[model samples]
Target chain A: MRLLFTVILAASLSLSGCAGTQQKTLYDKLGGEAGVDKIVTHLVQNIGRDQQVFHYFAEANVKRFKKHLAWHLCDISDGPCDYTGDSMKQIHDGMQINERDFNHLVDLLIDAMYKADVSHRVQNQLLARLVPLRQDIIYR
Target chain B: MWKKLCILLPLLAPLSIEAADGKLIATPGVSQIEGAAGGGLVPWAQLAGYASRDEIAVNAFASRGSVDDYSLDVFGAQLNLYDRLELSIAEQEFKVDALNLNIRQRVLGSKLRLYGDIVYSRWPQLSVGLQYKQLDDALVANLLGAEDDSGTDYYIAASKLHLGAIGGLNWLWNVTGRYTEANQIGLLGFGADGEGYEWMLEASTAVLFGRHLAVGVEYRQKPDNLGPKEQDWKSAFVAWMPNKYVNLTAGYIDLGEIAGSDDQDGLYFSIMGTF
Candidate 1:
């Protein structure tokens, strides 16, 4: 148990040290526009291949989704971009996306971030910005 | 019991391996001592495995807790159906060194999700569960003036997970209200000669670091119905999930007093496998 304690202590210390180096904005840390675009592309590709959530995207316009989602990510991450797309509730109002699919999308996003070589710290920052939008997008 | 688990686990594994692994890793909590998906000692609202609504899940766990005057070992299995209902069975062995007695008990448990989701829903997830316990040997309980050798515990639990809520890490919490008549979680028996049931509140809080590790604390209120002054159970735990299939937990436990023994505190360890 003491070993476990030390491990957690060490991990937390390293994480805090990482935090101490957070002078860069989340957008800058996400590799700015290019990295965000890469992550969004991977997320869309993952969703296209996802068996559980693909049906929800089947009737949708892939090009439009990719653009708007990228814009949304950038807008939320304090990037110098503004999303002119519809509100989250407006776009997902009748989709009736449940918790399962929502979380599946989040999982895909995490994978996307990983593929883009985003650090866990930066990934969490992006997720923190996106999670609040869940209320507007689920079970509408 | 270990031999039995060795056989039963392999048999159970194949069935769940074919089931859909819909939920994400580390979302489903570890099995509690009573076989419910939860923290070390308190049952949370989450089910036992990573099954989503369209899948079924099976899990097995073993736990041991040793204190100043006694030790407890538990072996349990759980079946989760469609991410909504949970069924579980657990066997407990309580060894009292002071009395040189080995007491055994069996627990059968079921839980049904009542509302929401732990992560994505607007509100926290909620569930109701029941644990029916029977003492294998009634000698110690009867001698302690317990009313019955068997009893049932009913509880309602609410659980929530907040993404990046604390220091950019996930935070989880569970609150449970249980109405039970058992003493020493049914090893010492149920109720008193005149008493019936009491409501006990239990709580657990945890923070997820990265995706694999969780650190938490739990408190479980106890009912005192016998000569021994029963105290609440408290613990600080760390759970590591290397993947969806396995979780290992270690903790320091404070069990207070038991059967006239005071300051009963020690260590706990558990391992759970989900298929």
Candidate 2:
């Protein structure tokens, strides 16, 4: 059993090693504050037009929504900013956010990133880091 | 027949990754033999696709593997509905170019996600799977003293992902138990040397890297139902899902020996599209 564990450990190292050392925070890859703002702007622009998802944004304050989201992304990506907003559960509690809505938002976000020309690898990295947050934000 | 399927497969697949592309990328591994989402050579309990309970997705894949003198090709398609049930059909061809002999088989499979979401639930995803395998080479089966050329394998699998479990790394572990009498995965025959039913254990473990890539190893225990000695199967693989519609896997597999053949080890490659 110990031998087997060792073998797996070695295999994992071999695969992970090639990731190449770039200690830059996801914040930098996301192009810092300027880059994040552009993505948030595009995202909000789409929310009002998306038929299946626009209804949920009916009462939303587009300005505040964009700001909060930008700060949230910046903070989570290890950017040089802080998100002092309420927890995901508190913010989405009464909203009755369903999976479809959540996925819609995800789509908008990806589009926003693409508009900003964020590299695919960086996009994937950011998304990966944010995915775990779904448990906290969905159907709470 | 293969030519017609080649054209029909794409029309039935690819949902197109519209956004975050969350559900499709690397989360659900590639479809394995007998049709379950998993590593290259072994099936994990993961359902195929990024679709949640409210959605549906379909995919098809082709794999070609060469080990020493033998060439194995497999193709299949699957439908994942509501992230709960998976229905699939696959065909396999084992060719010995040197011997000018080819054996074919068909696999029909189904898996029910009994409980726990692989990604969301705190508990591991557990599923029950059944695969019905039918071989075309009845002559070889009969000569091998096989009781049947077809058999059904029943298995239950449990899988868990320990997110950020080690060194800010994620790892997945899976365990499966199967009851079968198919030797050489039904290529040589079924129910001969050690007939009836035999229980086998399969295990898989992988490390998730770069969010969209995974490296893993699988160990699948096999039943020595037909003589000459049946060794277990093992493979180490790297799987990548670059986007929602494309997934590629490359690996090295040691399929052990088959019917007096030497230990078969070689490169394995598979490409799949999810819709």
Candidate 3:
């Protein structure tokens, strides 16, 4: 009984240590809505510079797209925001998006994150959240 | 060596970093010891190639490592499909001038990436690889007490990239478990009179410097099937990429006493390119 009790105490202590002294949400680390807005704004700008992907956004409503993207990022980061934009499939369907375009967008997004001074941890976290959605965004 | 260098230089000339979107970048982790994908000396969980999830790519490499009494030269080619599977072949010659021993080996390898992405996924990427190693000299195998001149090595590896793990830099960690009897990676043949296949471990960790450079160390456990005291191997290496097409790597290696010789410390140089 005493050994089991000691093991439980050790496990709890390790778990607490892994939880960190202070847990900051990824949303907070990314600096909230204002930060998300800055990243999305720069992301769209970089996308415009990429010739391979630029054509897809050539006729897009920049202001609305930026707003929806910011909210979507916020939603993914566990922030207090709702991504009420069109479904990813609905927006990307019939775009004939290829692997090159998807990777190029990721590169652009990374550039935008850098421009906004987003931490590397936050950048990877965001990329991980978005990478799985490739199934819906590409090859359709 | 010069002839191979001439062939590689021309292929690397036309590729600028930004021009190759559909190509594989010269990431150091893609170069393995047996001329497969992984670290300089140990195979990582990632498959070899610059191919993305939907592309096909081919890569080839030539490398030289020299010690006081020996020099090893390797030339190899690999094909990566959709960044998921890899097939490779290598021919290696170990020339021990002092002992008047020239050993040659032919290695055929294949790797399958089971799941996860090294960079994009939250979980570590895992792969299983098989290598069929055949030695050309039967006299050396018999004299050295080797049970066979040909054997297969099977390994499972897991690699993870931890972004911002070290002072805002990316860190890569890999662990591999191998079942093999090949002595000194089959340069000395397989098995012994007293022993059969043995299990070993290879672990590697690297910290990325920017996007084009990685500095790391690797530790490889070797089976003690040889008569002499052949200890584990360790090395510190740096891999640099000037562009998407070219990769250069150098390492200071300590391969513990082999064939009754004292600790063999050496320098390793490798140049590789993908098309």
Candidate 4:
């Protein structure tokens, strides 16, 4: 009985140490910029075809928008992307936008990300980073 | 005295039992998203994040107010994940009478609370989300041949509960920031002439006055999309919840615009049901 108890204690200790070592940081799980770039590309492509929102971007340079969007996502996620686009406030000034419009845009982006097979955890992380912009985007 | 002790004993005993059991027995507040034991009529600036004590909920809404004269319909779904995060998707259909346009759009987003309680508990909650929108090309082409309406928006929000010293009334306050890049409507034309990005800031608060009743107010400031300008709005509302499955909300909204042509006020109503 004494020998058995000693063996059990040693096994539990080893298991706990292994568990600690297996923990992974969010940055590692996200696959870094490469993963974010793929997700951004998917999102831009999806938006470009969406008629409901496309009217707003009819004149937008898609290539430029894509590059800026990718960099913005990286910067927001605490990664390394420098964004040179206009400030959000400077860009959206004018046409009377509302909460309904904003919500519609959110739905499409989520669908695009889903189609890209972005992991739910990474999606949640990205969403959390984006929530603060409600004030800046929903004018009326 | 014996009768009084009997009455008191029953109440006091339960309190002690609850304490021993480690079950919080305070009056329940609204659940994070799906109408728990609290009120539902008030609008929370913070997305539900992922507090899923309840199950999934789906809601459909339609409204016509004094300001726009257009009929709007909204459909939405909310899900709680891992009892800590809330994900929601919503779509809006706008029928513009003046513009002779019918536009439909969809937004899919998720919110996760980094910390805090959505209901009954007293921790601060933080959330983030992203949205994409697309316009129907036929509608855009019909309304404005050269115009497109598609883009992405992102947001982050934080909320805290304040239990006032007077009568311990429950109060919730939240702040959110949003970044948007999309096209706006032109007065004389459509398309690239009215496109830009915007940064918005908003704040809201609600106070609980009775069981399943709350009143609140919200304010938001955003950029003008037509020209070099900006605009703001304010709203006041009341919420009522009779149970944990249904919610009713009504409010008044006001918007400020340039040249006074877009200034308007209207009433809004919404119903939410959770399974």
Task: Looking at model 1 chain B, report the run of 10 residues with the lowest lDDT sum.
Answer: B16-25
**Docking quality category of candidate 1 according to DockQ thresholds:** acceptable
Ranking by lDDT: 1, 2, 3, 4
Model 1 per-residue lDDT tens digits across residues B21-100: 66767878898988899998999999889877767888899999999889999999998998999999999999999789
Give the runs in model 3 whose Cα sits over 4 Å from its true position.
A1-38, A75-80, A87-90, A93-100, A115-122, A125-136, B8-28
The DockQ score of candidate 1 comes to: 0.33
Docking level of model 4: incorrect
TM-score of chain B of each: 0.97, 0.93, 0.92, 0.69
lDDT-better candidate, 1 vs 2: 1
How much is B45 displaced in model 3, in angstroms?
2.0
| Residue B103 in model 1: lDDT | 98
Residue-level lDDT of model 1, residues A26-77, one tens digit each, is 7888999999999989998899899879998899888888888888888898
| Candidate 2 residue-wise lDDT, B1-275, digit = tens | 45755797656634453322335347688878666777766677888877676777787888888898788888898888877898888898888776788989999998899997665576889998988999987877787678888998888999987654533457788998888888777877778844788888999988777567888888999987765778998888888877777788988888888667878889999888787
Error of 3 at A71 (Å): 2.6
For candidate 1, please provide the TM-score of chain A on its own.
0.87
* Interface Cα root-mean-square deviation for all models: 3.8, 5.8, 9.5, 19.7
- Give residue B271's error in model 2 in angstroms: 1.5
Q: What is the TM-score of chain A alone in each candidate?
A: 0.87, 0.82, 0.83, 0.72
Stretches of candidate 4 exceeding 4 Å from the true structure: A1-140, B1-68, B118-123, B138-148, B165-167, B183-195, B227-230, B258-260
